[model samples]
Target: MKGNTNKIIWLTGASSGIGEALAYELSHKGYKLIISARNEKQLILVKEKCKYPENVAVLPLDLAGFSTVGNGVKIAIAIYGRIDILINNAGISQRSLIMETGLEVYEKLIIVNYLGTVALTKEVLPHFISKKSGQFVTVTSLMGKFGSPYRSGYCAAKHALHGFFDVLRMEHDKDGIDVTLVCPGFVQTKVAINALIGDGSSQNRNDTATEQGMPAEIFARKMIRAIEQKKYEVYIGGKEIKGIYLKRFFPNLLHKIVLRSQYR
Candidate 1:
């Protein structure tokens, strides 16, 4: 594994879950981290927990506020001089039927999950290109590869990220830019509680499988390893993560299996 010592990393959604865990893990490993999230308090807590607290910088940010990300990027770059990696881990989930979900609900999901990520990535592209070296690590979900019931909009946003970032990799590969798309099936995070409901309100409740999902710290470790190897795409999670392959190789069989699966 390549040690990330001295590498400048910009991580979004660092308030909790995998982002927070990754902040500590990477900082401990000697990476200079600039962590961002909407919750400044939680971001500070993440920094405080780092084994190398001085290596972590908390830059609280709201991805939904696309216009302000440029300023955030500027501040991060000013602090670190150059960013070697950008981890787009900030996103919200949805748990509502297509018909039951309001138009506003769909808009909010797409705007925050897809548009916000795209805006921030665009903001940092010039710097990466000029440096002729950088990595874009995105934390998409299994929903990105296969759609399930009650996650119509969430699926759309994740799928769009693949389309956009795949092209980015193709176009910038020669420029020393690397893109790693991480699709995890599920991990014990507050994703379900923060998920948007039919009326666009937070679910504020945990789902069955998610409650027993993989630990965020372990997920972050695997993610970092994948990023170090520059894998174009990697799936991290439990048995359910294999569905990505089953869906591709045996669509009909996967359909039947998923139909009987409890996750849906």
Candidate 2:
């Protein structure tokens, strides 16, 4: 992959999982990284694990607090001079059926997963536009393309990202701003355990499918390659990733298969 050593990349949700893994991958490739998450200590730990710790900065942020994201980006720009890439990887998930889910739970998931990401993207966009060069790498999900049982809110949030970022890519393409939406089928992240339940409570337990999902490091490496190629959208995972195409080309068969899948 082509390395952009001078590019400054700002990544959220860097405390663990795919975000942390990407920090290591990108840092090793020589990109200056600014990592953010609500967990300050964990963000520091991620920075320490980077090949070039001196090139990584830890910025703790809570995506749920969308109003403050602009200030956070301002602080990051102050430190890095300019941000060449914005990776919106911070998001929450839902692990309950819609009927069993509370309205507040749905709203919270939307706020953290969709709205917060959009807000942060908007915050960094002006800088990109002025410079006429930047990339926005969004970590959505395969759920964005196909709805699954027990994840109505998560599916909704992920689907919304597609609509939002797709438009951003079209509107800003001429400005040299590229947007890549990454939809992974099942990633072995703590997402399942951290997923919100119907009553707005954490599941606090990993699901079987998630346990068998792709490793974060492997996922991150593929993502880096996709970003380098400037692909507008890419799907990554194991066999499950094939569902994206199946869902598009053979809806009925895909529906039947998904309905009978053990992951549901």
Candidate 3:
């Protein structure tokens, strides 16, 4: 009824990692939540962990299934009549060099990461437009801002989100629609383990950098603060966030660092 209190928040990829942390964080702040993910079992577990479990709804969704996301959003909306925020935090990562990766892997990454997010956003856009008030929060990566080895396809997908959402923010400013692009460098999660490899198979291995990344709970806390402030774009991470600035001022230096990274 005041500020973010009692607002309805629809969050995707809510079963694990940053999404899971956010569920708890937002629930404690008194937001009614719709949590979605591919795994219903895990989603239920996340829901039960929330401070206000009764305020949460679990909707299982697979990002790759484009046609299904629309229905997912519809179900989410029915829970609270309207949704004040939609968080597009669902996506897959790549862990193979472009040359080693198959075309199908790139296609799959685009479908699940780029197109899937777009489809869901489009589904929710009409609702926001009708209300003339809503916020869209997308979780991209530090990789979105620059090129990185072994993540060619993943980088492409994230870059596409930046382009789409930047345009959306501009076009919908008069409609009072807010967009936040979150660029996270690394957080201790299973992302590396679940990243797609050359054949579209999971890498199943965690990179050393991922092992040394920020805790997901800490990242979620900062993210919630950014959302509350309605920042257009926010970066979170360790030294990796500096890459965004480095790419702007010292492109050659950042390129060299990327080439020398353990990724290669």
Cα misplacement distance, residue 207 of candidate 1 (Å): 0.9
Q: What local lDDT score does residue 179 receive in model 3, on the 0 to 100 scale?
A: 98
Q: Write the per-residue lDDT of candidate 2 for residues 181-264, one digit (tens) a residue.
A: 999878899999999999999999999899999999999999999998889999999999878888889999988888898464
Q: Please list the residue runs of candidate 1 whose C-alpha ends up more than 4 Å from where it truly belongs after superposition.
A: 1-3, 262-264
Q: Which regions of candidate 3 fall more than 4 Å away from where they truly are?
A: 1-3
Candidate 3 TM-score to native: 0.97
Ranking by lDDT: 3, 2, 1
lDDT of 1 at 133: 98
User: What is the lDDT, from 0 to 100, of the residue 219 in candidate 2?
Assistant: 94
Candidate 2 error regions (>4 Å)? 1-3
lDDT on C-alpha atoms for all candidate structures: 0.91, 0.91, 0.92
TM-score of 1: 0.97
Task: Tell me how many residue pairs clash in candidate 1.
Answer: 0
